[model samples]
Target chain A: SQELEQSPQSLIVQEGKNLTINCTSSKTLYGLYWYKQKYGEGLIFLMMLQKGGEEKSHEKITAKLDEKKQQSSLHITASQPSHAGIYLCGADPYGQNFVFGPGTRLSVLP
Target chain B: DTAVSQTPKYLVTQMGNDKSIKCEQNLGHDTMYWYKQDSKKFLKIMFSYNNKELIINETVPNRFSPKSPDKAHLNLHINSLELGDSAVYFCASSLGPSNQPQHFGDGTRLSIL
Candidate 1:
């Protein structure tokens, strides 16, 4: 069984639309991270959450960690075309042996 | 300078051969990891090293070995390579085993013929 699971394997939205990607875990998330990967490119770190009910934002992207530590969500506000990529969620419950989810592919069209 | 670098961005070789992929991270991180992404894009961890010491080794076969010369370099050597070895290998480095973000090399695309 996958320790981390993401919803909506793929999604598409028009530019300036808001979208959310959800990640669920089977165990407590010691540290949860979000990364974005373009085709044929390496992953780029977006954000990380260590405390429950923690919320972090960068530009138009914001991520929230639930108090339960089993679910996390990434919210994109007024997305742009450049926001399109594979969104991956990784969690290391014990702060070791991090595992990544299958990823949610996002496509923001112009 | 490349933070995390891997040589031979692409590799194509036949089965039952021996090959090596070299990875070096200039970030001076203490922890390094090897991840394999299969054709289906499912990424899995194969091994992790902390300060030249093997910290995590998955259920990988014996033919696959990871060597860390120092805190900045980790190389992978594969022997008797099987067809199943065809995939993308990624080298990533982080500050430590905690919540630090990992910096990954572009990746080495290996194709087994």
Candidate 2:
């Protein structure tokens, strides 16, 4: 089984602060995806990185996949209260199945 | 409009009963999956179907079955549900199983009493 470890199980920060969450995989990733879930809601696709060293951003959220193909990061700039939610990183080792991270619960305070 | 939707948003039933959750996606995606988020908040893949064909099946108990009648629908049926079967079940869809990002349904919260 491909395994993924997410750091900082939970985070609290001021609204304007910048934050980053890390996802490390035990196996090479076929692709990496970032998702955000508001409390009690379903997961929302944020970004997808397929190639090594790929990077993509959506508004204030940027995601990067390292060259090693086993690590990825999600960075949020000038975070806002509306960004507060549980962020999950999912890795597809062979691009056949997806396994999600344990999820990083983030709190962006006003 | 909701792109992906699941019916029976919340379910509460006694053990040994049978239940089914329905899912539909209008995204024109070719692949769909079923996932379970346990009480500990760990999301695990249970099953995956591509174009109405069973593609991925995890080590889930045989009691849990996923049926997809077409590319747009995937339904989960749990027979003789047990107390341990309670969790938030999610349905998702993607263009491909290997590389595309998926769209998800809000989720169905199930509780087996």
Give Cα-based local distance difference scores for all models: 0.91, 0.93
Task: In candidate 1, list every pair of residues with a backbone clash.
Answer: none
In candidate 2, chain A reaches a TM of 0.96
Give per-model TM-scores: 0.97, 0.97
- What iRMS does model 1 reach? 0.9
Q: What is the alpha-carbon lDDT for the whole of candidate 2? A: 0.93
* Separate DockQ for every predicted complex: 0.79, 0.89
Residues B1-113, candidate 1, lDDT per residue (tens digit)? Answer: 99999987999999999999999999979999999988877778899998899998988999999999889999999999899999999999999876788888999999999
Per-residue lDDT of model 2, residues B1-113, tens digit only: 89999989999999999999999999999999999999978999999999999999999999999999989999999999999999999999999877788899999999989
Distance (Å) between predicted and true CA of B95, model 2? 1.1
B30 in model 2: Cα distance from truth in Å?
A: 1.4
RMSD of candidate 2 to the true fold? 1.1
Model 2: per-residue Cα lDDT over A1-110, one tens digit each: 78899988999999999999999999998888899999888999999998889999999999999998999999999999999999999987774467889999999999
TM-score of chain A of 1: 0.96
**Which regions of candidate 2 fall more than 4 Å away from where they truly are?**
none
* Inter-residue clash pairs, candidate 2: A95-B98
